[model samples]
Structures are given as structure tokens and as C-alpha cells.
Target chain A: MKKIGVLVGVCLSALLLASCGTSGSTSSSGSKAKGSYQTTGTANSGEYKGIITNGRYRTSKSRGVGVSQNTENMLNLKSFESGLTTISKDHFSPKSYVFQEGQILSKGTVENWLGRKSKDNPEGLNPKDNGKKDANKRNPIYVQQIEEQDYMKEENGKLHLAGITIGIGMNRKDYYQKEEYGATYTTDIPKEQMIAEGKKAAAKVLARLRSYNAVGSSMPIVIAMYQQAPNDSLVGGTFYATTVSNSGTQMGTWKATDLKNYVFPVTDTDTVPSKNDADSFDNFKNKIQNFFPNLAGVTAQAQYDGDSLQGLNVTITTQFYSETEITSFTQYVAKAAQTYLPSGIKVDIQIQGSDGSVQSFVARDNGDKGFYTHVFSSY
Target chain B: MKKIGVLVGVCLSALLLASCGTSGSTSSSGSKAKGSYQTTGTANSGEYKGIITNGRYRTSKSRGVGVSQNTENMLNLKSFESGLTTISKDHFSPKSYVFQEGQILSKGTVENWLGRKSKDNPEGLNPKDNGKKDANKRNPIYVQQIEEQDYMKEENGKLHLAGITIGIGMNRKDYYQKEEYGATYTTDIPKEQMIAEGKKAAAKVLARLRSYNAVGSSMPIVIAMYQQAPNDSLVGGTFYATTVSNSGTQMGTWKATDLKNYVFPVTDTDTVPSKNDADSFDNFKNKIQNFFPNLAGVTAQAQYDGDSLQGLNVTITTQFYSETEITSFTQYVAKAAQTYLPSGIKVDIQIQGSDGSVQSFVARDNGDKGFYTHVFSSY
Candidate 1:
């Protein structure tokens, strides 16, 4: 209740100064605002809690246009954000908390934090630039972007900021040029070094966030470190590890999430972590490919927790357009998925045309007895 | 701009009274707002001009959660909204106008308009109820929803409401029951009758809009009529016709857009308007299907302007996952699209996995010499 008073006071003053103009704060009656906002809540977790947002769309203060160069990179960023929230829910119960987009860190503050620590920008999280043209000597941008997601608890009718989760998107490979229009050079940051740098950066972010009066002193901060996939990767990277600091700026010991993603029917045997998962996917792929002669390609992104398969997302490219054909094919796919796929895991299959329009969908949640199928009706 | 002064005055007054809390008015500096807002702009039209929004996401006043019952219904609603914007470009040049989501119609007003006319609700646009339970005697609700898009022109850095486009989504098939939770019955509305009812509703909407002080007199208004597709249909309905009222509340004659969409390889000969288009699509499909043996499906959605082909959206579902195979197949697809498909029309092809993840993209703009292709890189 006291925090609400302070937030309202800050908002009232900001409104008068016209400084925080439409910052999407709690002062706004959410129902009156425009545009639909949705939570990427999972059904298995009993739904992600409260809508702290005004149900209005608000662009991130920094990188409103987005920094992802392509679709693959974009997916990587999305997965990192959503995956972090999932991890946070284990510590911060969704049933007891309200979800809100990061608002504590101002655009100027975040921009400064993402930059290389220089004489002017002392608050920068990345290593100070050496101003060297050589790839080996030059300091790469280890921390690409810092994302904050605020968690709140409702007291009375108002929501109070209770927790903060920070997602650090660290670059695995840095691409840069020595001079303007010069030949580009690539610097591959070792995974160990990236992890170390990411943790250090997160600690700084936590300290900075704690300095803000809005973030209570005893607030638990969750830090998720993600290794970004290369720009050309078809699949995005996954959150490898996370840490939580219950109080002050010091973080707890890092806990290995052991989450990994792989393209199914992986050509390279060395990269396949689990032989069982690979064999299962191969069987599923063979069954589907044999079932339909006109099949174009069957590929999947299989997610794993250590050696155990967690979920599989499969796409079946087809040449069929008729509703009857799609319907029959979808039924066959559901059967194949149930029979061939690894049991005790969530499997989602999509049958699409060459144009990428989904013709049918077959899905089975974890522990489900059978897959549910739906074929799109052609008008 | 006097409009700026008026809007600022209105916003300031609302702020003082704590009434319009974060209405997302022009008074707020857009760069400071939260969440991304995007225009459904097309490339051919030079680009839908102006960022009239604060770039913050705002939900629709009436149906923020949306009224679409399923995925099919959602797509229908989306296509209807986007198609209306595309049609609007013809009358209102995108280069000269700034697009903003409908904001003038308050939530209460739209709710009343969507309701059936009764003794309590006189402002209701639908027909009055006679308290009859019979299907034939009972009055079916015709108008489902009204969408308003404001077009603005900049003068001295501030945007002014120069024009407005109203989209009327009319029900083609009304499903209802005599009593609550009773046996449902369907009422099929003829195309002629739907159009008449849509136009009648548009006239009323225009009249009401004219009464608003924010909407300047002598402003041009474009009204588009969209027939809602049946709930089961995969594809959404298109905008059949549109009319423009250059001045005052009087509308002009309706002009047929002549745009129609069809699923490729049509088995129903009567529905296939152009024999040449069907032959071309068949040839194209055959070439791609023959090029690859493991293809799941190759389907296309072709849009026609009268009898002439306008654009083609093709989806090729594949079983191949190898980078080399996808690249080689994409090249063949590009060649097949160019050699077999109809010329002088834009075509877009997507090679995707059974999970619907896009693997490769092949496209050719109108009057292009060759198709451009890109295969997604495997990580």
C-alpha cells in the first residue's frame, strides 16, 4: 500500500512534468486503454498470473524496432524472454504474482548498461573498449541486450512490484568491422567466457535495480543467462543457466537449467546429446515420410532437459490442398506421432502447404493418452 | 494546428479530473510509450505513411479480448481488417495520410451499436425484437461489429483528422436458438441482402461520426462492406465492395473490388473462374512435385482480380531436412515458379517443415526478371 502511494506520487509528478508521458504505469485505468495484450502463459503451469498491464501495447524503451537481423534471431530473443519467465515461475509462483513488462529500468539507463564501459559511460556493463582495430585485441560486445520482467503482488486493489527477472542475451559470436565499409571480422567468444561475462553483467544490473526506490530492498531478483545463436542459425538459442539473489546485490550460486534445442534428424552425430531422442525422432520422421509420398520435408526442433526429451515441435510440408486429403493426412499424423514419438513428452505437429499455410494440426500434451487433430477447412 | 490545441486541452482537462488516465492521446510523446505497434502496411503502396500511434499497443475499446470463437474466425477477422486497409489506399493515398487505429468510437457506443434494438436500447443498430421464438418470425442480428480507422494529414508537425474509413462486418450466416441453451438454428443471409444491410448500417455510422466535433465537416469517408466467412472456413472472406463519400454524410455508388481468393488445384470446376490460372497452377505444382519425391504437399492460395491473376501464395511442405537438399530444392522451386506459373503477377512461396517453421522463401515481384530465393540456414 505504501509502494502504491509512492508510485502514484511519482506518476502524478511525472504527469505534471510531462516526463513519463504514457509510460503505461499503474495510474492508468487499464480497461480504457487501447489494443489487446496477451500473456505467453502455459496451460501446464495453471496459467501465468495477473494482468498488471493496461492491456495496451507498449514498445520497449530501447530498441523499439528490435535488434534481431532476421526471423531466426527474433525467435531466439523471444524464446529467451519466455523461457526466463518460465524459470522464474518456479521461484515466483504465478498464482501469487502479477506479470508486467519491465518498467523499472529507463531507456537511458538500459542503453548505458548495454554499452561498453568507457570514460563517458562508466555504468556500461560490457568490458571497456580498447579502441583497437585488431579482432583479437578488440573487446567484443559480450552483453547484447538486457531484458527486465517485473513481478508484482496485489495488496488491497493496487499491485506492488515484488520481484525482477533479468535476461542477459550474450553473444556467442561477435561480427564487427575495423573501419567504416571495411571487411567484416568475426570473433567467437568461448562459452565459458560468455557465461562469466553474463553473470558479471547481471550482478551490476541487480545492483542498479536495487538502487531504485521502486524495487524493495528485500526483493528477490532472478537472472537468466542466454547464449544467442549465430545470425544465420535456423533455430534460436536456449537458456543454459539461471541464478537468484534473494536480497541485496549479491547473486546465489548458478543453477544449470541444462535446456538444449536441436534440429531433428541431426546430420552430425557428435552434436546429438541423446541417442535415444535421435532414434525416436528418426522413427517418427520415417513413419510420416513413408505415410505420404508427396511429402516435401519433415523437420523438427526437439527440446531436451539434460538427457530427457521435454517437447518436440514438428513441421510436415505437404502438396495436398483439399480438405478431405488434409483431414485424412492429419489423422494419420496423429497416429504416427502417438506411436513413434517419445512417450511422456509434449509433441506438436503442423501440416502445412508449400506456401506455409497450416493445413492441419496434431498435438499431444505431456502425459496425454492421445493426440488431438484439427484439419483446416478450405472455403 | 487548432486540433492539436483542442486535443491537448481535452487531454489536460481529462488528466486533471483523472478521467482519461493514459488514453494514449497525442499529448504524450510517442518515444516514451511502451510496447510495439505495427501497421499492416504493404510494400507495393510505397509504405503506409506516418506513425500516428504512440507506438504503444492498445486494445480495441469494445472487444479487446476479441470475439472470434476459433483460429478460423480469428483469421477471418484479421483478413477483413487488413483487406479494408488495402482497399482504403485506393481512395485515400497512403503517402498523404497517417493511419491510426479506431479511437473515436467509445466502448459504450460500440456496445450499444452491436446490440439488438429494444425498448431500453434505442441506439441499437440491429432490427427490433418482436418477442417471437419462431425462426422465421424472429429478427436475426445482421451487423456484428463496426471498425473505424482514422486518416490524418500533418500540418505544422501535428496530425489532423482528414478522413475516416468504416468497415462493417456483416453476418452471412446467423446461428441462434429459440431459447438459451436450446436447439440452435442457422439463418443464411443472401449476398444481396447482406450488402443492403451493410450499406444501411454504414450510413448510420457515418451520420453518428459526423456529429463528433473531432471529425471535421467536409471530410471524406470510405465505407467497406465485408461478409464474414462461416466459422468452419480456413480462409477468410474478402472485401467485396467499397463506397466513398467525398463530402457530407451522403455516400456514392458502390464500386466492386473484383478481388477473389481460391485454393489451388481446384477440383470444383464451376468455382474456378479462370481456366488459364488453373492450368498454370497445375503446371507449377506438377513441376515442383516431380522435382522432389518426398514432398508432403504443395498447395497455393491464388488471388485474382476479376479473371486476371494478381498474386499467388504457395506453400511447399517437405520431408527433407538437410541444408544442401533444401537449398537445391529451393532453386528448383524458384525455377519452376518462374517457368510454369502465370507471369506478370507477384508470387510468394514458402518451404516449411511439418511443424510450419519456414525453411526457405522464394518470391518474384510483378515485372521481375527472376525469382529470388533464400533457404534458412541450419544451426
Candidate 2:
């Protein structure tokens, strides 16, 4: 009996070992987990559970009532708005404002209503106080404008903006047009200003969670910033920035995989002025234009390795009367280009004749008075 | 005891099977046979089973006479001559002749002696009766000449020959000066005539070899004919033709792996007269001298892919007083080259001025009335 017990024990141990090894090896290489939320209570029960969605926090109980799909959607919307408000306040400051998609009490909505007058509503709503009971029944998420802030502007008869973006929950429908989201001013503001505004707006986005007792169930929220095109007819804007709130334990694991930093324009006020090699090459070409009276024009292309000028190739079209003239012209052009081009910039000059003759010269600058030159000709 | 015997038998069978498998697998991958010659008889014995030295047959018998180093050397010399004579007769024919080295009895030797003689021996030795017995004592393999064939000639004071080469056994020292063996006639003789003369001389060489029976053994022989240089001082001649004799069974297998054939001069008598493209280009340049008065010279290089003319590159160095003149000159040259060059030949023309400017044109023949022209220039 003792021997049998020992044998049985060994067999059981082996089976356990085998099972453990198999499970450990298969998990990582197997299927991924589905669904973002963890259910804590029975469906539709008054019992509540805290849920984080899109980085924002909410609860399953809707105002102390049973959880419903509609209440879940509303909580999701509020969570999204809470995340946006955090972003706007923390980052954008004076340059940006946060808004809910359906909140009718927002200043921007009231202004919009006052501005658009129709035949049926000849008396436009007052900007200060529209005083309508129906307003409370309106969607709870709506555009909000900060004090003394105008979200839209016109300049030079063209509409422009810093940028705008909008995102809907994975399970909900988008209620607004793509253009109604993130936007910038219409004026030709400096790139530096625009980039500053964009960065400020990005910083205001909160990577946190918020739960309103007025709403039900925990909800997840994701906020994305879309960049607006200077001209809508040109190209549709793209999502440029993103942040999440109410992710709870998944907060550390949830990665904002795609984000782009705004670029500023180079202005005279900047610390360093831009130097273009192509512009310099064009200037050099102009200097040599008069040297060949018979030449029609001179064109040049400059090559660069990063910001350092590597080489310049120039071509001129002209007519040659004799071999002597061709030689003289080639020498003259070579000398002129050598003198006109910047030091250490290698230049190649090619001249083509109307009668189908070509002469080419390469002048390499060694940072000295004279240039090392090589000439090639096609006869 | 029976059980033990059965176990032992089984073990023995397994061992046998393993050994057989190993042996069968190893034989194919084993080392290869070494050395070039097959060993027949015991070494250093007067009784030799046939041995092949340098691809030639030899036996242990040393002529049955006392072995002397001088006799051996003479035999070796004789064998070499036999090879040459065979080659001359079998290949060169009436166009060639063979003369034993230092053998004044041979017509070609006597003539050479006479030709080199000054005021004292100007009459030269008689071809049949040059009684100077010392001539025979001279190295028997001294120098052989094929006759009626002045292998070398002076043309306009320049020594010239067609070209020729000869390679002897690996270990033997070359007895004759390189120039003495292969020669070309100075005069412009038809290739066919020279070949005929060489053949005849070769036949005579064979006849002379049969007279020397002192060697008392048949020998394998290889003969090589080297073409002579047009001007011996200008360039060394190259190998031209070859033949063999007394090679026996080995003749078919013994290939002249290094033999090079003579390139017959292209002459007017041939079915297809040779046209020197360089000369043609020079002639064309001369014809267009008047068109570019300021030009120094027009040089051209022609390229051929095998026998097919491919292209010509021409360069003209000159001076041009005005652009108009340059254009006209370029156009004139392009048109002239297009008309002068052979059909399907592409021509590139470049004109360079004294002052260093250059004009180039490419005219490709399209098998039409005009050429497809392109112009390149440097101004």
C-alpha cells in the first residue's frame, strides 16, 4: 500500500508538471484579451462598479439607479468632456478652450444662435440671455467659449485656423462634422504663435479619470486632436495628438502610440536667419549672365549634404562661332563662376551651342584664389 | 551455454553490419591518387618498360653503345630538330623551309653565312660542299632557318617580320635566340605565297632529319611557328602556327594548347577589301580643312565591335571669332561627318576653341536621308 501510494504520488506530480509547462508556453503565443471593461456586478442591477474609460472615471450606477445603455453613453460623453477640460486648463491656457459636443449652455452656442437669423426666427436669440426652457433639454454636450475669446475669425477673405480634432467613443456615433472640432484662428499668424497655441492646447489634455455622480456606470474616454488645414479645399485635416483618461490600472500600460509635435515657422525675429544655397546659386548665375552675350540663359542646381552645400551644377545655352571663341567663352565663364561662387563650393559649368556642340568645365574650390579646373568637350 | 552462444552470435552480426556500412560509405570520399607518371618496372634497372618523358617515348637502352653525355645531348638536339621539321612540312608547306642549326650543308644556312660575310668570306660557303669540318662540330642544334623565306626584311630602313613564337620542353634550356627562330619577310608578299613557301621549307626539313640515323630511336616532336614583327625593332612577334610529328598515340591527345594563328594582312586581292577606318577619318578631316579655317586639326578614334564598325569620336581644336562662326562651323562638321561616315556608325564631334570653350555634336545614322543629331556644349 505504501509503495502504491508513492507511485501514485509520482504520477500525479508528473501530470501536474506537464500541465503547468503546457499552459505557461501557450499563453503568450495564444489569442489576445477582448473588451476594455471589467464587469463587477450583474447586468442592469442597481449594484454599482467603478469603471474607467478613455482615461476618465465613472460608475455603473446612473444617479443611484440601475445601469442602462443610454446612461452608459452619457457617462462616456461626460468622461470625454472631463478629459478635454483637464487638457485645456493644464496646457492651452489663454490660447485654447474646452467644449462638450451637446452642452447647449455654452457661450459659443449662444453666440452662434444669436448670429444666425432665419426667416422663421427673425428676432435672433440674445447673446447675453436667450432664456429658453428647451435649452435645458438640449444635448448636454456643446461648444464652450472662454471669456473674451473668439474661436473663429476671417482674414484677407480667407478662413484659417490653428487646428482642431474630434473623437467619438468606440461604441457611439459622432454627432458633429469633422471640421467642427479643433480649429485655429483665420489670420496669418506667425508659425511660432500657432505652434505655441497648438502645444498649449495639447498640454491642457488630462491623462486622468473623473466620475460624475449625476451619470451612471464607469466609462472610458479617449481624446484626439485633429490639425486643421489652412484651406479646407486643399486637404482634410488629420489627427495630430491624443490623450486618455480614466484608464485605472491600465493607465500605465495604455500607450499613446501616435502623436506629432507642432513645428514653428522661421521668422526674422528668430535667433538665426535662414540661408538658402539654391538662392545663392541663382545669384551666382545672374552674375555670369552678361559674360556670354550669345548665351540665352543660365540655370543652376545646388546639391546639399544636409545643410552643408556640396556642389552646384550650372548650364548655359549659347552660340559659338569658332573654336577660339568657344575656348575663350569657356575660360571666361569658368573664371567668372569661380569668382562669383562661394569659397569651397564646387561648381560645374556646362555650355550648349545651338549647333549641337557642348563644352563642360568643373571648378573645384580649395579655399584659395585659384580653382582646380577640369574641362570636357563634345565635338 | 546455448543461450550464451545465441547472444554472442547476435552481437557479432550487429558489429558486422556496422562495419560494412562504414566501409561502404568511406571508399567514395577517400583520398585521390598521386603523381603524374605510372610506375612500370623497378627503378634504376637497365630493363625499362616504356616511359613517357615530356610527352615523348623513350626506353632504357642507351643506344647499346657506351653512354656519353655528349651523345645524349646530340640525341636530344636531333629530336628537337625532327620535331621542327615535322611541323614545317605538315603545316607551313611551300611557303616555309627548315635548316638544321650550324649545318652549312643546308642551303638556307650557307646563304645566311654568305649574307653575313664581309670582304673576306663574301663568296659564302657552297650549299653542297662547305668543307669546313668545324661546322659539324659546332652545336648541332645551333640555329635552324626555313629558306627561300627571308623571315625578316628591312622596309624603308625599318626591320619587319610577321611574328612568331616557340616553346620547348619545361626543363631544357632554349638554345636559339628568340629572334633567330621566327621571322617575317620584309617585302609585302601575299600571305598565301609566304604560307606556301613555309610549307615547302618544312618538307625539306623532314627530308634532312631522316639522314641523321645516329640517334637510333623514334622521337615525339612538337614544332611551333611564330609570326614575325612588321618591324622587329618596334614590337616582339607573337606565336602564329604549330604542328607535330612522331607523337604516336599521344598525337591526338597532345593539343597545341598555346598555339596562336597568324592574322593574314587584309589586301585588295581579297574578296572583301579591308577599309582602314582611321585612314578614312583622316581623309575626311583633310577634306573639311577649308570649312573650319581657324581649326588646328581634327582627330578621330574609331571603335569596332568585332568586324562591325560601331562608332567614331572626333575632336576639332580651333578658334572662333564670333558665335555665328562657331555655329556655322559646328553645323558644317556635323553634316560632313554624317555624310562621310559609314552607315550605322555613330559619330560624336567636339570642337574646342583656343580660349577653352567647347561645342560637341552627336550624329547617329538612322538609315535615312539625314542623321539624328544632338548637340552639347560648354560656355
Candidate 3:
């Protein structure tokens, strides 16, 4: 009984150290309040215990903390994080598993893996440098970033790392400046090569994770492959494929994700696969343009899986000052959206005045009839 | 009795048209939900009924929508809006007034007001164009943008526009490109002149507001002057002065708001007025840097109201992949912040890994002994 009590104490301390090691002042996790499992202090009243985050945010091991403020990379960053979280839901159900940030992968290990294969860093996953300055000859940095998320489950009143989701962000283009503060040049990587390289990188990451004693061979892992947008693109990239290894060090059979993202009123006809979606968006745009003659521009970004549209994010730029005018215009937009745009897809519309502050927004959930609208007041 | 009823019906229709004309679907304002006055659908349990926005966002009348993605003006944009809002709190208390977007000033009027004063546009507030292409002689568009916010009060079971706050954003430097996709040149405006011009413009704006029947002589107006940061600045501008004119169109006594914003680890000694505050930040930064050897940079944006510091927003850039390291480091940061920084000020610290994603944050309110830290997990 004494030996058993000591072992239990060790496990409990380890759990506490992992969850609240930052300040050690926050409320403890798995402190059952009534019937529900309580975790973080975040207000959550549901069956699924809210994510017990360690307060560590994810950053790309290679990119430094953030890109330049001027870069259009923020869009890609948002998609990469949110899209990975969405993919995590498929394997790690929020109802059964509690979300925790991946704590096992140390900073040193991730940094080494992101670096180009070198003599000193033999574990590097990226292609080795060949001492060539030419864009065509030089190998691009195929694997840009890796993000890991761990799902926890309570067993014997203690949270256990049940499942892990890994997101590998692959670059579609490699940008390099010849000199400091000089003009930037780009080298494009073929889509097929990027996908192939991503899968290989994912497998290597999996193998490395398995080497850790905590993450044994039996641990279930889900690896999602993301193709990042080019540096100049306004919209972000999407996940191309994903694989789920139920219980092994080896990766499972790859499943191609038909997910795609396209800016509406696409300038290039070849970029958009669906002409019907383009036409539908055009109708919506035209309706809005016709209503407001002095509109600066009306643009939308649509996401699709296979042929059907999954979501649409629209931005309308116009000159507005009055409450009555905004209200009347918003009503017109809602009516136009319902009549012209494709239904059965989640849609969000943001109306920004010439000054760029959000004037109003119209949002509709998937399969919803009525649209929800809100106007922001400056006062 | 018949004439009185007709007049009441007209007034009621006008009120409805002003408030809920957008969709006429959401709940009406001043419905009085139990003990509170309900406005929008947003959940608000405070005495303030919340803002009754008309659903129109503010954009720069001159700039047109958002600036280029690469420009560092977003920092300035945030300060201009939030700073103005903060200034408004002094005059328009949430307990008595409901916030609303400006309604009387039409888009055409604002657009015209932002243009250069000429024979065709007599009401233009900006200096008339001299038809000079030379940067030295050309009249700069000193009046960059204008934001108007209305504060409403409940009277006789109806909302009335009682107060108005106008934020006049003046440019410190005017950037002009000779040709499309060409080299950009800047013409700097002297600080003394910018302030003088802003005050002059404020009086003009006041006179215009008085012309409107809804905003007549009795309506109180607060106009705050903002000296915008240059195009290349990492930090934003600050509100230099503000004047509140009560019950008349004439300008009131201008009060110099000594509110200033500065980037810490000061490279230029002349910029920071208080030397002790600078040394305090250095001590705090050094403590964290000494503890962690590998850090990209540690910087803070400190806002000071006169000689006293109001708030500190610090960002620490480093490489982090593990939750344990983040937790440990966050604890150290919290300790360092408490020990080294100013005691009676709100401080927020965000730690970002090399890749640019936030690892964790440590925040402490004024007069608080302990800090609140949150770690965001990928899962």
C-alpha cells in the first residue's frame, strides 16, 4: 500500500507539472466540478472539457516568431492553424479527448528537423544545401513548418496523452533576397513534388516521435499535409491530404484531401476549377455592385472540397457614414446574398467603409435560412 | 388629437428607420429587457445598453479602404481608433450613454471635405491645390481621415444623440509617387504646423456639425487631434490635444493631452522624456535576456500619460517548441516583470517563438501582486 501510494503521488505531480508549470497559480485540471470535468479557467459549460492549454503558442521552427508585417502571409498562417485544428476533430473528438499543446517535442529537436540536412545536424528533414546560388539548381526548403497538437483523455482520474495531430506546412514557393533589404526573388516548387516531399517529411517526423519513450510505437497519430500559398497571394493555402496511423510508428495509407481555396472573381480562368461557382459568385458581386454605385470593390474568397462549395468569405468596400444608410445597405446585401449566392454553404460578409473599419457584417451558417447581421458603432 | 397622433407616428417611423432599417428583423432598441435597455443582440450585462451601430465601418476617406499589406500603418490604425475611444470614455460615460455610429454626415460630404479646397469644392477643409508638381510647393493633404462617433442617451423612453466625438487624423508626412509603380517621395509637415492645422480643421468640423438640425447648438462635441506616425514607423501615433465644446458651435478651450507612445530599449535617447522609466524597462528586459541566452529580440511599446506610464505591451521573440520551456520561461518573465518594471501600471508580455507564433503571455493588472499567464496549446 505504501509503494502504490508513492507511485500515485509521482504520477499526480508529473501531471500537475505538465499542466500548470508556467505560474502554478491557476486552477488545477481535471478538478471535477459536480459532474463535468473541469480543466482551464476558461468559461466552458459543455460535456467536452475545454482545452487545457499549457499557455505555449505554436510558432514555425524555421520562420522566427512572425513574418514581416507587410507580407500577405498572415492569411496563410490563420488557415494553417485553424485548418489543422479542424482536422484534429476528425480523429480526436472533443467529446472524448481534451486538447493539450504538444509538450513532448522540444524546441531543439524541431529546430534541427527544420534545418537543411547537414553533417552536424544529421536528423535534418529538409534537403541538404548544395552550395549553389542558382534558383533552378538550388533545392528549395520543401518543409516550411511543423505544428503538433496532443489530445488527452482521463484514465484513473489522470490525463493521458491519448492522440497526437501533426501538421506539416510545405512551401509552394521559396523566396530569397540576394542582399539585405534588396529585392526578393522566388523559386516555385511543383505541386506534385511538394506533396511527395511533404509525405516523406511526415513519415520521418513520425519515426522521430516514436523514438521518444513517452510516445511509443502504439501511440495513435494523425498527420495532415498543408500546401502554403505563395508569398504574394491575398488568400491562404489549404490542406491537400492527410493520413491517420491508428497505432504504429509507420504511417497509414495516404488519403487525398480535395480541399481547395480560391479568390472569387478569379483573375485567371485556369486557377478556378469550377465555372459554376465562379458564375454564382459573379451574380452575387454584380447584385451588390448594382445596388451601390460608388463601391470601391466587392471581393470574396471561396473554399471548396471536390465540386461543392464549403464556405465563402466576402468583403465589400464602400463609403458610408450614416447609421440609416448602413442599415439599408446591409439589408440589400443580405437580400442579394440569399437570392444570388449558392446556398447550403457557410457564408460570411464584412462591409468595410473607405476608412477600413468594419461597418457591418452578414453571416449565415450551413443550411440556415435567415442571415445574422451586426453593425459596429464607433461611439 | 388627430394632428398630434400623426406627428407622433412620423417621429416613431423616423426613429425606427434610423435604428433598425437594415433588416428590421433584430430586436428593437429601448425595448427595456427587465432592468436594462437592450440594443443589439450582443450579450451585455452592464448598465450600458451597448452600442447601437448602423452596420457601417469607417475607412479612410482619402486613402480608400485598407493600406497595402506590406505597410506598417496597421499599428497606427489601431492606436487612432482605440486611443480615440479611450479619450471618449472621459466625456461619454458608459453608464449614461449608448454608443452609436455617426449617421448625419453622408459619405459624399465626408469625401468632399477630405478633398483640397477649390472653386468647385468650396466646403473642402483641406488647403486648396496649388497645381504644383514639386514636393516642396505642393499643398499636402494634411487632413488625412476623420472618424465620428455618436453617444446616445435615453430620454422619454427614446434614444437621443446627445454627444459627438470626432477624431481628426492629421498626417505628419505626405507620401506621393510621381508615377504608377514608381519611386515614392515624402514631404514632412512640421509638428507645430500640424497641430495648428488640426485645431483649425476641428473648428471647421464643429461648424459643419452645428449646421445639422439633429446636432444643433445644444449638442456637445469633443474633437481630439491625432498626429499620425510616418509611413515607415513601426509604432503608431498619439492624441496630442482634445477640446470639448458644450452647448454651442463655437470652439472651446483646447487641452494638451500629454499622452505619448514609445518603443522601449530606446535607440534614440531624445524621444523618451522620462529616463527612469527607460532604465526600469532595461532592467526588466535584461533579467529575462540573462536567464534565456537564445532570444531574437525583446521589445516593448510603452504608453505614457504625461510623465507616468499607463500601459506596457512587450513582445519577446525566441525559439520555443516545448510547453515545459514556455511555462518555465513565462514564470521567470512574470517574476522579472514584477521585480523590475513600474509597480503601478498594467503590463502585458507576449512571448513568441522564432516562427512568429505566440508561445505564451504574462499579464498583470495595476496594483496586482501576481501575474496571469495563459499558454495556448495546438490541440
Best by TM-score: 3
lDDT of each residue in B152-243, candidate 2, tens digit only: 22244332322111222111111222244553222243445444443444433434433444211243333454333232111122233455
Q: lDDT tens digits, residues A82-138, model 1? A: 576667788778788756667787667778887889889999888887888777788
Write the residue-wise lDDT of candidate 1 on B273-323 in tens digits: 777678667766765664434545788877777887777878888655223
Q: Could you give the DockQ of candidate 3?
A: 0.04
Model 1 segments more than 4 A misplaced: A1-45, A50-72, A179-183, B1-379
Ranking by lDDT: 3, 1, 2
RMSD in Å for model 3: 14.8
Q: In each prediction, how many residue pairs overlap at the backbone (N, C-alpha, C within less than 3 A)?
A: 51, 111, 25
- The candidate with the higher lDDT, 1 or 2, is 1
- Candidate 3 Cα misplacement greater than 4 A, ranges: A1-379, B1-49, B52-72, B268-270, B289-294, B323-332, B353-355, B366-369
Ranking of candidates on DockQ, top first: 3, 1, 2
Score each candidate by Cα lDDT: 0.66, 0.34, 0.69
Tens digits of lDDT, candidate 3, B1-379: 9999999999997785454334333332323433234443222222233332232222223232213211446666557766776688789986777666566676678777877899999988889978776788888888876777778887776777889898888888888777778888887888998988898898899998898999999888999998887776656787888999996767889999888888898986457877767877876676566443355478988888888788888888876434434554665576567657767787878778777655556777666767765443321
- Candidate 1 docking class: incorrect
> Model 1 — TM-score against the truth?
0.47
- DockQ, in order, for the candidates? 0.02, 0.01, 0.04
Could you tell me every candidate's TM-score relative to the true structure? 0.47, 0.20, 0.50
TM-score (2 decimals) of chain A in model 2: 0.26
